[model samples]
Target: MKENANSALKIVASFVFVFAIVGVLYVVYFNSNGQPSTDVPVGVKTFGSCSAMSSFIKTNAQKSYPSYWGSGVVRAFTGVTGAISASPSMAEGGKATDYSTTNIQVAGVDEADITKNDGKYIYTLSGDKVVIIDAYPAESAAVLSEIAFNSSTERVTEMFVNGDKLVLFGDKTDYNGPIMGAEISYRPYYYRTSSFVKIYDIVDRSNPILTRDVAIDGNYYSSRMIGDYVYVVLNSYVYEDIVMPNITAGGVETPVAGCADVQYFEDVVDSSYSLTTIMSINVNTEEMSEKVFLTGNTQTMYVSTDNIYLTSTQYYYEPMPLVGDFFPRSEEKTLIKRVGINGNTVEFKAEGSVPGWILNQFSMDEYNGNFRIATTSGHVSRSGGGSSNNVYVLNGSLDTIGTLEDLAPGEQIYSARFLGDRAYLVTFKKIDPLFAIDLSDPTNPNVLGKLKIPGYSSYLHPYDETHLIGIGKNAIEAEEGDFAWYQGVKLSLFDVSDVANPKEMSMVSIGERGTDSYALNDHKAFLFDKEKGLLVVPILLAEFDAEPQSDWDYGEYTFQGAYVYSVDLTSGFTYKGRITHVTDDSLLKSGYYYESPYSVKRSLYMDNTLYTISEKTVKANSLIDLSELANVSLPYEGSDYYYGYYGV
Candidate 1:
């Protein structure tokens, strides 16, 4: 009887122990929120080397929980291997090849002039290399011919076709010897430079000739042609000097400033220059002139029939000023100045100011008799971070028209466009959404509707008044150490005929997926062809599988390319075809051999050709004939450059 009783007691104790263990397991699993379970061994250090802990768990633990058993085993093995191969393998260079048999003609030009002329024209700065390609119905278009420029390395900064004259501006700067002696190379100095503006007579496209070149002290940033006068914005440098002195203590010497009676000194001045001028050139006589339009720090300018609008932002610098030292001052204000063009005098009568941040993004459109300015405050948050979507509207006189109500909490606007009686705003969050507002009444705007999507829509293009096109996607990172490139390019079409209820019609994914920066139509399509539509879009592709660096965080990663797509708004806004990267073998080889670190700069569809600018090359511009690639298929092979610097 005693032996049987002892055995029963032992069995009850075993049951109790098993029940306690089960309860503990249940609690842990419940706390994990349905995630796979992990072992927490007693007396074992959780924060120790992952590989060591993994090995311990594998050896000591009788069995892993069924839920996390696979992941736990894989992690343990991976940790050991990762520790052994802690150092990554060296990356290799990448090469891209043409997989298609189609031939795309290269116009042999780097950098074409982009102007919203009748259509767009690709003018090679090197020579009279002009290729007029059609942008309408992007497919089935051909290049007109190769037109040559008058000079080599003329470097056209701004060009506009005004009736019979092609008004152009060129900048050439040469640095004199060091402002200070080379022996005192650490010191800074300021030097003067010169630039010029030229006008060309292109009345006859076949026999275009340079009319005149006017010398100026500053480089021209932009220009506009009105009547016989060509208005130009010139940028010049303004220099200032700074000094610093060294102090010593005993004759043997202490280099402290407060220690010495007789001090040895060194003067260090920042000899940098700032932009400061606006000039006008008479197209008829080619004479250069100036106006008294004083600006603080201008970034952009726009001119209409009645007034000229100038956007300026205040620059901030560190190091507060001492009593007698020349320290930088903070101008806690942003200025939007409007000047009236009375005769030749630009009367700056109206101005407006905003607090804390400067103007970083803006869009201007004229409605009725009033000009509407949609401006966004710089990404300056109270927490000292960047946000892109705070939007404000201004009137023609630079007055605060109104501010758009913030659509989503913590969401900021990326872009705003005016279409007929309404305005479309693009905002960025986890995904992008289109907010439609009725602007028939400029003062009291109404949020008529909204549309949201999975990716980012950076730019919006409207076809007629009923249809809209959006270009957007999340950027992809290049490699382990490099930045994130663009990824998942999607083109979405929307029907906005009903302002209150906008609907998405269709979407198409092109290339490997990328981003679109700009798109336009040729003059023939813009003016005459209503039945057939032509649209040109510039697309920049992100490197495959590119991701952000582990340490740095500045969400900018993109690869450059130009894509021209044709849209038919009448038929569910269908995309016809695309013409991209149609160039000579030599040019393609050069582009492949020389990779640019910066994004693709600009693309313009003018006359009948497509012009593209490569930011990677010093003077990278290419002109391509659209007709050659109408039937060509783009190759989708992988890149050869493995970005990893593993072995080296």
Candidate 2:
């Protein structure tokens, strides 16, 4: 939540490769408009026609990239390529106690987050260190083990836990290597980085044994887990003529030793040095496989049960803007590639193109052999100029079947969610327009209903089949024509019981003028359980004496923590309370919202217990009365940890 280096590729036709060991193989194509090109059920397309792919690159890649970027764009997308989870946190164990897993997009696929649970113990990244808490007997909870990153760039960001093994993903800056027999003078100030994956065996609970240390060039783009395999994507730009990777499987291997292990697509050599390598590692067997895509720098990625979608934006260098325009002047197009994931193999599926760019992973969904996507088309412009939003329905081949284009003319998409046969879209300019779209028929998707509300939503999640929860900021119309000033964090519940008429059933705004929450930008921080009727979010509230004079005037910090709410399907929202790790009075008296420096960033439910975590503490509260039952403060002195060293 996250394979080996060798893979068996089964060519479906002449261009597509199906990675399935034993299953149905399909050869899909699209006509001029975007639909199935043929009706063939099985065939082979292993590496695609070299001549046709070259021609496609010549026609599309150059025009797709900006002249400034030069050779960064792909020559022929007419070629092949490769590239989340689809589920919620499931309570797997006993009825009296249920633990939460990572909230994912697909049921079987899991996405790595900051925190992970293995039923009995909860593993979380606290600053640059990881803390494993023995959180079973509510009253006897305590920190089990703590592991800190050894280097500055090795700051742990996310992790995944499966059985007795824990995999941690982090990034580190590149330091100057030894030259001749002596080390280089000093490292550059610029950020030259590498991504690291550390696999640890936590079977002993008290002492975690680091099993594998896999370091890859480039920064971490994204990752996913399906069954026993962990797939990680790293995007790197070639800088020096020589590159070395440090890998520790059986023993420590230098750049020279690991050099021979690096492989690339021989047919497409990336002149731009933009390299994207996807590595799949098996946690159970420790077998690893990698695939490299030249000039395939990923922007947004979506992973399904059987397929992966990689999206890249192509900047089209064009004529100058009219006098005073920056953003509205540029023209761009986005390309999507599909890759097959079977057991330990990842094979190229197909490729397609769309007009503009996508927002995030939430904007794409796979359901009933149809992939539905929402995109904000064109550059943002004054008046509706060329700006508009659209929704497209693509079949298994990724051909456009039905489309609702030029929607909400002047607005761009903020968030989108596709549930089963239904799709929900939120676009904002001055006011938020929540649209409920009916996708019962892929060939004819129409907006069933729309509700206009204040502010906008950045993330959308399903509460039930007919309910949705939105997390964003509350804003008020400003002096400008259609401008708004964003305020505190806003949590809204929408009732979509009637597809023809969706309504905001309950709306709640917390904090003061400049409050913010991690949930607004990161969906993983949001915790919602329908059966438990619980909603929890991390917030940093700020109070303003009056309307601020400028945007930077973030007001005075007041309170920082998590907000607990008992949400009812029909009754709306009921405020439970706020949980904070800060207990310093002198620091709180200084008008700082996050007095403890470390603030609560996430919350999850373990049966009837609610757990809130910060960089230095973990608190458990009863689900019924919200009373603190157990608390464990992490032991890491201020200057001991690279990240927590600041102690500000």
Candidate 3:
């Protein structure tokens, strides 16, 4: 009986050994095939790297081997699964030029006007030069004779064309020499001595003669023409002169002479700089009329049929008070008012009373005959700044229609456009989600959908009701010797047919990293005819190179030509060529070049032309033919600064 029991035990032990051997073989085979093994379990470590080990063998030596076997196995499995789930490749297509060279001319380009007149001629303001281009046979869109102001220093601030008559508001600046003993080496303070509003008769496209030049007092900042009357906004003090006091050896304040009274314009002092007024001029009769006295600083004005909307922002300045010395306290407010143009009455008003500072710039779009205003407001603390966008839609009478809040958290709204029954708001921070709001019901609007991307978008234009062309920066990689430094602009095409689920079709980066705004012509073909459908992309190339970044200091850069592209709502979008620069030596060398006056930070697009305002030039506009200017290489050739990506 004992011998039989011993034999039974030996048989059981043999069975257990065979089972263990089989388990080991299975684990080895599973691992060899890039699959998870039961016996050899994979585990993640502190470094997030993976390691694998046999369950039966647990040893300190194995733990010290520094093997990433677990990670390798997971990666292998991921690769297999990804291969199985990959989508089919898109069909390859031929590349097409974005823009074709049609006509080139020397004119100051502003975003204010780029509308087609009589369906054949294109009117645009280029500094003191006003150009009318024929847009019929493509080649016919050449610049006719340009009207120039007699003085080389005089410049046109704003312009509008109504049928055959074109009205221009111009301002001239005279230097009062250097502020202090500093000669040409110092920045000169400019004083505007004269302002003029001129009207031109352009019945004949080739020869547009000036009809009247009405003198305007103060600085003519901006103007809009509706019917026979022209509404103008004027300001005597545009900028404040800030002077930081120097500390002496004995801890005494050393006042700098000729500093132009740094605190002269503060509200507490009630200085002359606080005064500004809005006026109206009759183009048909050539008569001047005062409309309203703008108490606060007015930045931009929009004129509709019955009302003129002005965005009024305030400014403040004060000296830092000593330990016990009285400190000057000042606060500024941003208010939007709809004033009656015919009767000169304040119709509607909405003011932001928060303690934080508000930017003077805002975007206005007309939807279903109602006006929509989108402005940014935020709180500024010592640690950081936070802001929110407030969109106010007003009725035809300038009454409040609706409000959309928190569209962008902490980002400023740059531009807004209405497409069909929806409005798209563009923001400054990263490629913001395009908030698609339904304006079908003007009073009670609904956020129908949103389009999100990975980069920043300043301006959005609709190719149709379903597709939008977002102009901004994508990603960029800088090459330094053998190494590469990468950044992104986030320039891309988005399919918004399903607004809720907008898909990023494709995105390409321009040369370096910078902000870009696009100007698109919508009447022409979406994909073909580069000369017909133009997309002007103005890249603030210099801002990418500035240091100690100042909110006000947009780098000094020229209007680096226009980048043209073609868009198709049904299929997709394509990068066309760029408008080639005028090759003629005379035109290239002419002093009448485009300079961006506004800080490079802001994107300006008016009509269908793009404008980049700079402080170096009196005229701040650049007119670009998108269809004909895309794919055209810029003349800049440097290492730190290169041409921005024209198209993606």
Which has the better lDDT: candidate 2, or candidate 3? 2
Candidate 3 Cα deviation (angstroms), residue 568: 0.5
lDDT of each: 0.40, 0.67, 0.41
Q: Candidate 3 lDDT, tens digit per residue, 1-648?
A: 011224433343232211101000000111112232233213211111112111111122123111112211110000000000111222222111121211111011112332223334445444345556543334323455566664555777556666577887777565554456333232225454446667778778688877776554456666555556666666543222322222122323332111221111111111112223455656666555443231333555556555655554432324344345222233333345555556222222322221222232325655566776665664322222356666666776556768767656656665565665677676545335667777777777667777655555544545455766665544212222211222333455667778777766766565443323322221111112222344435332333454624322333333343344544543354565443233333332222233321212112232333322222111112233233321111112112111331111
Which candidate number maximizes TM-score? 2
TM-score of each: 0.56, 0.79, 0.53
Superposition TM-score, candidate 1 onto the true structure: 0.56
In model 3, the worst 10-residue window by lDDT is: 75-84
Sort all candidates by TM-score, best to worst.
Answer: 2, 1, 3
Distance from true location, Cα of 237 in model 1, Å = 2.7
lDDT of 1 at 531: 28
